[model samples]
Target: MTNAEHISEIATLDNVVSPDKVRLLQLLQTQKAAFLAEPYPSYRSRIDDLKRLKAAILASKETLLSALEKDFHYRSHDESLLGDIFSSLSSIDYATKHLRQWMKPQKRHVGVVFQPAKAEVLYQPRGVVGIISPWNYPVFLTIGPLVAAIAAGNRAMIKVSEFTPHTNTVLRHLLGEVFSQDKVCVVHGETDVAQAFSSLPFDHLLFTGSTQVGRHVMKAASENLVSVTLELGGKSPVIIDNNISLDAAVSRFIYGKTMNAGQTCVAPDYIYCPKNRVDELVDAIKTRYLAMYPSIDGCNKRTRVINHRQYTRLQGYLEEASNLGANVIPLGDVASDETSCFMPLTLITGADQSMAVMREEIFGPILPIVAYDNIEQVIASINENSRPLGLYIQSHDKAFQNKVLRETHAGGVCINDAAFHVVVDDLPFGGIGESGMGSYHGVEGFRTFSHAKSLFKRGRICFSDMLFPPYGKKIHDLFYRFFIR
Candidate 1:
């Protein structure tokens, strides 16, 4: 179809839903029946599905970007291309390349007594998988997990966040062109609908969002004993070592924090820097931010906050910190107008545990800088809280980098950079304590949606029969004595 026709189709689909629990069940049942009909899809079939998804993404790239812009009012085009489009396409490509090896049955060792038998593990699909994606980076978060589910030879039902309604419409249209409803479907709804979607008896469920809502998802999933892979957000910390250059550290920090206006789940939540270098670090960040985004008043490249509610929440964080006697610093001279939901890159100094900004996940363009007297203090401070989804450390010194990495815990880490570790296809991306649980990326993702079923086959001559219990004979006694010792 033509581009205009596709756009018209998406606009028609935009008014399609009101978040009915009944529809969620119908979709689940449809996918479950389809999965049962072909429980173990061939490797070639799985590869074909993945290739189709990749093609769909490529074909709908411009439409997806436009929808994202409509949803956020003024989302950065480069951010959408790099973070969402590029990442999803990369994941599909990586999965397709390695799927043949992943689908192969792994040969295992047979014990001495069972020598006549052969053992191996078969990877089987886990039927219908449920995916709950958040609004921030909507396309990537939704499609990323769907790629894993498809790679594992399973059908999926995705529930996109209501906050990004326009993007959801585009996703519905894009996925509809690529997949049958029974094979892959996308649902759009509000909080109540999300709760209903979570409670479904899915073979596996994957959720990506805030820690607060993650708890609710887990609670609802428990009723069906559904396995979950939660990619939740927390206070991801960045440590600037005393030995590193302030300019180098701040440059990396600005890229991570300013991307999506700090709406990233793995975005640097706060900074732990030496007490003396706080001013220098802050100044460097300010200078770098302005160089990139000279004026946020009408800059198209600069992403705005998702909406007024989120914008107000971030503004409240700044106001609360200010009221509590913290030094609130704006990074640029640009003033944000209310119509655009624009929030400038800001710095909160003298921030302590008591301040809301420090206590909560700052999912906006607000950075809190906490001073540390020593390296030991930084380690102690990090350990005291829930492990974050990601940790960033900047230092040319190997010892300092190694020390920070070894002492602290996080789902992922980027040494000398920030938030880039997640895009690496080789690494398994996930969270530890509260940030999240379970991982999905590369081989880890393939295994997450598959069941490793152990298989044993007996030969013509079964050696195990010799040890079958009748009455203990002299040969059995000898065998037991030799093996037990």
Candidate 2:
């Protein structure tokens, strides 16, 4: 091949790879090269990155809040501060605090047969991690995994949700302030760019979104055999055991469901309460929720549904449930304002598995309550569906809580509460089965973006030469006879 045709020939190029794909490929190559140049970032360097991340988040706090409001229609500033800003800052602090310990090689026990050799695991950085963050908690989801990637000494490229154009711009600015494009790149476009981005060969890809789209992302990543940590959403259930007070249980789990107006992945999708106490539960929920969200007040501090499409989706859930004979209870003075896209926390009773509300993941402020006769029914009913990202058990009875914990499966469990598990730094936030595949929060987050490479080193003396002969000797026979057992 001469210099003229060294790069490629027009006829030789794959037509399937579009210009958008070409740009993504080039970006991947650039990041991969940068990663190769500094494959393993040192402790000091990673700390510097974390520190810079913290500072940049603080510096861009106002802009981030404004961007979130613009994108979310009317996202609460406090919600953004807690979920997006503070959560990311907390993750950076956690990674910074624990990175030194996490980076240190872990020692492993050596068997008696291999006494002269030492075994350990080195946390190796898998180059060029790709993060596809959702619009719900854009900044946190993007920066959370990025903290892990940086802590693990890996380069990254983030593809934010297209629904969040304003927030995306702010994110690009926030990240740009901290690192160069090669070290940390931010890309955004419609679904086509997202598809092309996922199809790229990455060391690892972390995506936080709906379960349906999660499947597509996983399949696209599989094309390159890329590892993925999908933080997919599903129907997370909240159980109200007889031991706890009705009002108390509502207070704990209702906060989780209504915080992002039930737009949270781990929000309590439905409640499982005693059949006899269903009315009491409803009363408790109404009283508790109305206190927090009195009225629409024209969408002030009220988190509207992200857009009209989601607003209509939530409305459809209510309509279908009502048509199926489920009692739809709208709580606030103004239950919903379509123009504002603000839908108050509504409750559904007599819901069954057949309804779409129960079938799909309701990412809006709709809550469904299912009455059960006993704990067994609740556990059995929950098992019938796919595993969720989070599970909430409200009970003071130790045995009751233990039984629910052992009987059911979820990515994370919140005792007497909900959605708080995912926000914690130490806990591993992920899904099981249909909900999602992998987790990333703190140490788990660090490990998710890292390659745990096992290393074995020999001492001055050699242990293998004794057994490396053409024929088996008496020593080998004795060693095998003794060690085999």
Clashes per model (N, Cα, C within 3 A): 0, 0
lDDT of 1 by residue, 1-485 (tens): 63234323433454454347557776777887788789998988988888888898999999999999999998988999999999999999999999999999999998887787889999999989999999999999999899999999999999999999989998999899889999999987777788878977789999999888999999988976899999999999999999889998988777988999999999999999899999998889888988888764445567889999999899899889999999999877776656899888889999888888998999999999999899999999899999999999988889888998899998999987899888999899999989999999899999999999999998688656677778587769989788988
Off by over 4 Å in 2: 1-14, 296-298
Candidate 1 structure lDDT: 0.88
Model 2 lDDT tens row, 15-118: 67777777877777778878878899999999998999899889999999999999988899999999889899999988988999999999999987777889
Task: Give candidate 2's whole-model lDDT.
Answer: 0.89
Q: What's the TM-score of every candidate structure?
A: 0.94, 0.96
Query: What's the lDDT for residue 208 in model 1?
Result: 96
Give candidate 2's TM-score: 0.96
Model 1 regions lying over 4 Å from their true place: 1-19, 296-298
lDDT of the candidates, in the order given:
0.88, 0.89
